[model samples]
Target: MTAKPTANTRTIGSHFTRAGKYAVLSFQAALTIFPIIWVLSNSFRTTDQILTSIRLVPEQFALDNYLNVWRMTSIPRALVNSLTIDIVSILLLLAVVLPLSFVIARFRFRAATVIYLFFSLAVLVPMVTVLPMTFKLFSELGLLGHKYAIAFIYVAEQLPLSVFLMVMFMRTIPSELDEAAIMDGCSILDLFRHVIIPLSRNGIVTIVILSFVAIWNDYLTALVVLSRQADKTLSVVLGYARNEYAVDYGMMSAAIIFAIAPMILIYILVKNRLIKGMAMGAVKG
Candidate 1:
């Protein structure tokens, strides 16, 4: 007969398993971070240096590439445009989805299931599939080449998934809280404002970050929608940064660093909140 493993043997086996997992994760982290570090190093070096060797350390560090990108390129204006669109779109989406998601999660309406299913189906539809129709509508309405038009389009594009996500998160919040609030003579609006909003802060933050990142990195949608140079987003500006003859590796690296800096900063600032939120969500869910 086979012998059962002792507790000490089980503990040793678990240690090895955890150590293996950590080793794998550490290696993956290195792979992910190396490219970013290489780009940053190259952004400080001259074009000739980049062509010669893929080095982690720059021979001659200079800020000229960054200066050129800022002074000569459309990066600055494009950043402003991207920021405006992302922020405005996220606000509009939250405004519409928050209350809608609450109703869908809490209330039992005749068409609630249908509404939820419609949104779930919408998430599977490709944005490209509806582009031609959208373009035609925008052109007819004279909304083409406008920044706010793009922002509104972004909100519409993201709304379905946003609603679904918020609904799921709201479901995780115990209904007992809602019942208690109702018993205290709280109106629906009061319950939503005072109870649900506070509890769902982490989920809302995650949504905002996801939405901002999506809209910020968007290239195809912005390329199709905005015709004017002044209205172009950062992704469009980065595309235009490429040289026709040969890729300016140094300049391109600098532009990329500039483009990703905001996202990196945002993640860094809110990383703790993101982790806590996800953990809470998993437990509550």
Candidate 2:
């Protein structure tokens, strides 16, 4: 027979459990944020100081690193290019993936499973595996070094996972909703636009944020396809900085900070929606 704890003992146990969880959570958070803090701190340090110092905090603060990175590097232009690519790719993803997912989820077809399997397989194929062939294709099409080229590739790469996620979430939405819309004299397009899209907003947001993050951070595809400095995105531009400003630790740090800033801002703004969307999609799937 086991003895029951008194109220005081139970309260103490509960407090201990909560404290342990908080401690674990805080540790994890620190692990995640530490590098970012270090990078930011080092960005303000002189090159010699950064090279010499073990601690992240600089003895003397300097803003010239940021100024040098901004003025000398193609960071500003690269940022614009990244933004364009991300926005265009996201829009195209919405156009193509959402409808495709709806069809796969709502309708039963003979080739549905096979098609989905093929797409799932495509997702497993790394961009590196196809980069050479993709480069040849882009060259032949005269799309190499073009912003839209990157946008197109990003959309293609993102479609499989986006569709997969959307399909799972779409399944959670009752077929009754589609039937109701149809009974109200809604066409297929209308059903998708007014009913399905509205209902799947959370899932869409999740896809958008995920895709943006991926495309924004991508360097491999940009390196392979974009030949000109002017055409390069932030990732590629940052790569150049690694070589060109190798001795300038402060400048390099500043560039890294700039590269990560957009992603940080986006995560902060859409964190709640992102979590909700992921949870809903996971539960439905």
Candidate 3:
């Protein structure tokens, strides 16, 4: 007969397993962070240094590349445009999805299931599939090159998934709370505002963060929609930073850092909430 493992043997096995997990995670983190460090190192070096040396560490740091990038790119305007779009779109998404999800989760209407299923399926449709039609529709509406108006597309793109996640999260709330609130003379709007919305805070934050990241990082839609130079987003301007014949590596690196700064700052601010919200919301939903 085979012998059962002793406590000492099990403890040794667990230690090895834990050490292996850490080793793998540490290696992955290095791989992910190395490219960002390499780009930053390049941003501080001169064009000559970048071409002549492949070293990840620059001999010394300088501000010339960043100063030049500021002059060459529409940093101030594009930054404002990107921030406005992301903020507006996220607000619109939350405002619409919150009430809508609450209704679908709380009520037993005839078409609730059908509406939920429709939104769930809509989440599967890729934005690329409708690009041509979307372009034509916007053109016909005379909204091309309009900065604030373009946020409508971001709202639309994220709507279905937002509804789906919200509904899932809202469903997890106890229906008993709704009934109690109604018994206490709460109206539909009041029940939603005071009861359901407060309970689904984590889920709502998750949706906002996800929507913000998705809209901010999108280059394709912005490139096609914002045709005017004045209305172009940061990603679009970054794409055009290189000259046709000659590309400046150091300046391009600085431009990239500039473009990614907002996202990095956002992550730093909300990382704890993002972790908690994603864990509590998506997992519960």
lDDT by residue for model 2 (115-165), tens: 777766766688899989989999999988576777778888877778888
lDDT leader: 2
In model 2, what is the error at residue 232, expressed in angstroms?
0.6
Specify the poorest-scoring 10-residue window by lDDT in model 3.
276-285
Clash number for candidate 1: 0
Model 3, 6-68: lDDT tens per residue?
777889999999999999999999999999989989999988999898767888889888888
For each candidate in turn, the TM-score is 0.82, 0.84, 0.85
**Candidate 1: tens digits of C-alpha lDDT, residues 178-273:** 989999999999999999999988679878876777788898888888878899999988787775213678878888999999989987998886
Candidate 2 lDDT: 0.84
Query: Superposing every Cα of model 3 onto the true structure, what RMSD results?
Result: 3.7
Model 2: residues with Cα > 4 Å off, grouped in runs:
1-32, 59-61, 272-285
Give the per-residue Cα lDDT of candidate 2 at 195.
91
Highest TM-score model number: 3
- Overall local distance difference test of candidate 1: 0.84
lDDT for each candidate structure = 0.84, 0.84, 0.83
